[model samples]
Target: MTFREGCWRRRLRGEWFPGTRLTLRALASELGTSVQPVRDAIGKLTVERVLVLRPNYSVQIPNIDRELMDEIFAIRNLLEAEAARRCVSVMTDADIDDLEEAILATRRVYWVESEIPSRVTTIQGVSRILAERCGSEALCEQLINLRARTAPYYAAALARSDDGEDAEFVTFTIRIQDEFVTALRRRDEVAAAEIRKVDLYTFQHYIYRLLDVE
Candidate 1:
């Protein structure tokens, strides 16, 4: 993979936390490449607003404050709901089956693992599958970018949660995913869209509360 693709994948995997500064030299060393590719990748991601370009010529993951969180979630909710609605018409049986399996895998990981980053990556992977079958390349790209931006925050929130809160969040997530799959199976567009919105809202609610307390 190219440097940009690798960087993007790492972002989606929640490998980089918010406010983490990155330098071309460090990235080059980590990836076993020269600084030129790292610089190019950083430049592209900065333009995409997935990374912040500092005046000092270093890059950082953009930190999420309450206002930023609200803005990102607002757009995510709208786009993801629309994606779900669109999928009702376009997604094949295989695609739906894949999504179901992804959800099951994520549930297993959430219950069995204490690793926040792995959990975040698996959760986002399900959304990635849904976005791909949304039947609009433009919509898929937007959703990917939005997900990349918010992944670290998702990881951070889970990391902060106690065992009880974490368990509750996991239960809520699996229940919503199950409801979503059922909606898709029935080809109920409205129900699918509404369930997706509920899922996003619940996610925002937890993250928002965590940000407020911090």
Candidate 2:
């Protein structure tokens, strides 16, 4: 992948923490390149709102607050729901198969290991598959960009939860995936879209609750 693509993926994967300070030289060293490519990548990401460039020329993942998080996730809810609605018409058997496999894989992790982090990783993987199957590159790109911007906060929310109680959240996540997959399999566009909205609704509420105590 190109440096820009690599940087984009890193953001979506929540590799950086919110408010983590960074410099061009540091990123170049980490990516094993000189300053120019890293500069270009950072410029692109800043333009895309995946990173914020300070007046001092340093960059950092934006410090997330309830308002910013709600705004970003609200956009995500709309874009992804529309994508899923569009995807239902174009989805193929192979795509369904892949989704089924993803569901099974997620279940394996949940049942055997009960790791919230792993379960969350797997759930996002399924989301990527759904986005690609939507057949609108523009929609997929927007969805990814929005997710990349919020990924740090997403991870932060997950991390702040106690491990002992995270299994319930993970289980809830898997159940939602099952609902989404069922809607996809039945080619029910309304159900699929509604599911996406419901998923976002619950998550937005969760984030609000998290912020309430902070």
* Overall lDDT per candidate, in order of appearance: 0.85, 0.75
| Candidate 1 residue lDDT tens string, 1-214 | 8889988888887888888888878889989999888888888898998999887668999886777878888999999999999999898899999989888987776457567778888877767887999999999999999999999888777676665666787788878989999999999999999999998888788776665533
Which candidate comes out best when scored by lDDT? 1
Candidate 2, residues 1-214, lDDT tens digits: the string is 8778877776776667689888888888878989998888888889988888976668888986666776888888888889879778898878888977976785565346544445456646656776788999988888778777766765666556554545666678668878988898899999988897776666666655544523
Ten consecutive residues with minimal summed lDDT in candidate 1? Answer: 205-214
Error of 1 at 85 (Å): 0.6
The best candidate in terms of TM-score: 1
Off by more than 4 A, model 2: 104-120, 207-214
Candidate 2 lDDT (Cα, whole model)? 0.75
lDDT of 2 at 183: 93
Question: After superposing candidate 1, which stretches have Cα over 4 Å from the reference?
Answer: 212-214
* All candidates: TM-score: 0.91, 0.84
